[model samples]
Target: MKDLELLLKNIKNKALLPVYFLHGGESYYIDIAVKSLENDVLTEDEKSFGQTVLYGKDTSIPEIISLAQQFPMFGELNLIIVKEAQDLKLGEDELKSLEFYVENPVPTTVLVFAHKHKKLDSRKKITKILTKNNWIFLSEPVKDYQLAKWIADECKANQIKTAPNISHLLADYLGNDLSRIANELGKLKMVMKEGQELDEKLVETHIGISKDFNVFELQKALGNKNHAAALRIAFFMGKSPKTNPFPMIIGNLYNYFSNIIIYHTMHGQSPQVMAAAMNVNPYFIKDFAESARFYPLKHATRIISLLREADLKNKGLGANQIDDAELLRELTYKILNVDRLKVSV
Candidate 1:
């Protein structure tokens, strides 16, 4: 699969290759590429000449091949796009039909396959088929640890540099969703000048996180078993729909406890060592170490389970009437007053 940066660069250079296949976990890059291709490569007049878009579930390979083989009426190239190509049947039964077109795709037409979701099993024969003859691109999602860097890089890509702390805040707020983070960053960058330092104040004004509140302090409050502080933060988060979601909050909490679990399992390990082991920034180690002292491994795990249940309930499964604030209050009580739940921590 080609790198998204390189693919966009090539497209800008008017060097698009035929039979391009884009598949992966990262939908943001794929979406951007598709829009770029549609807007820059083919004009409205060219689309009228010869442009076909089909879903894999709707069209047969033969029908797709036929359209691809058709010549452009009055354009440089005809475009044949197959969206959700992973849904297309690819097996021994359909092998002969697919092979015939793959063996001899039309030269004058540009065929693009937008295969979404996780990558197809590499051992599958069809995976090899696409790689052997076509231009393939994977839009995989960024991993959690790499997300902060991706956010910073994106800001730089837009020529808008962010303060270091704001990068971490955006990563925590956005979680693992690169597409949402990118969209939010686009809005943020619009209000910034080149070389402007995007600080927490700007983010709070535009994106709705409290200027002073952050994942670090949130974890610190949790570690010390500060029920009042935790509830206050949760209430503030609930009031700000733009910044609050149970999933992101739960995920950050999970990471925090995971660090605690690691710290407990290791004997006499320095905070620096534990932070490195947990893949957390060193500055956060002080709070995490203190948290480990207050919330033992078993207690932290129990609270994590409660958080997971609250997450599900809020999603319309377990309890319907439980609002975010009440749900958070319940979680806070359970975490700070673990013995009150009548369960051994």
Candidate 2:
């Protein structure tokens, strides 16, 4: 992420590079980088004659090199962007050609490889050359636990204020799709009042994630051992299968209980220490502490097993023709009473 911020800053400052080999499993950053270089490096009139876009499947490394070797027709520089560079078939000859071009790229051309959804082999010579020159940008995907903080940071950067737990609520619903999350945030920014802070109600109104019936609330209910509240939430979620997918529900529960187990191990530690250990925001430390108190380490471990069993049943492994709604209800019941169940830890 620092590399991305630096890359954007450089582009904004017009500190151009000859060749940018942007390869990564996350396409959001790749798209942003490609757009910045394509738009910022060339003036509007200059882009007419100085820019060329190509796709990996439709071209070869030799052809790209040939384009890069060309001088700008009308401006001080030429821009050649190769989108979906990951799909290009790179054999030994192609690798050699790429390595040669990267080693001695033309000064008048800014060549970019917008590789997405995968990373180039690190052991490759061309990869090393690009990395050594600081021309490579590897955009790794954000982990699930880190999504909330990423959301909060983005909001702060955009001057969009949010209430506590709003980021967590969004993270639970949106998962880890950064692009989708950004789009939703953009929508919120557009509709928010001049000084309005985004809260659970606003998010639910705009994003369609129910504040009361979401997995986060369900987790809280179960953590507090409020059996009736947990069942109510589970039943509502089960009725609306499209909004609350069974697998997602099970996955969230699994993460929740896993964090509780972690909390047990880090008991008596400072909130900061526990939050870091669990990869969660310190704001939610009390929630984890309360959950750990109710479930304890052994019960939390057993709940994880129950979640896995429900997952298998949802997949029809041994479900006896049970639907997801029933499975969710049963899973919720089991998790709420996991303390009372006689099971191995």
Q: Quote the lDDT for 207 in model 1.
A: 81
lDDT of each residue in 1-345, candidate 1, tens digit only: 246777777777778777777888877777788767777678787787677889989987778777888888887788888888878877675656665666677778888888788676677565677778646677777878888877878888888776656677888886777778888888988887776789888888888777755554566677888877877776666665556666677777777787787877974878678767987667767766788778887877777777777788878788969887677667766777864575533
lDDT tens per residue, model 2, 268-326: 89999988887777888999888877887888999988988889898889869998888
Worst 10 residues of 2 by lDDT: 336-345
Error of 2 at 334 (Å): 1.8
Find the number of clashing residue pairs for candidate 2: 0
Q: TM-score each candidate.
A: 0.74, 0.92
lDDT of each: 0.75, 0.88
Model 1 clash count equals: 1
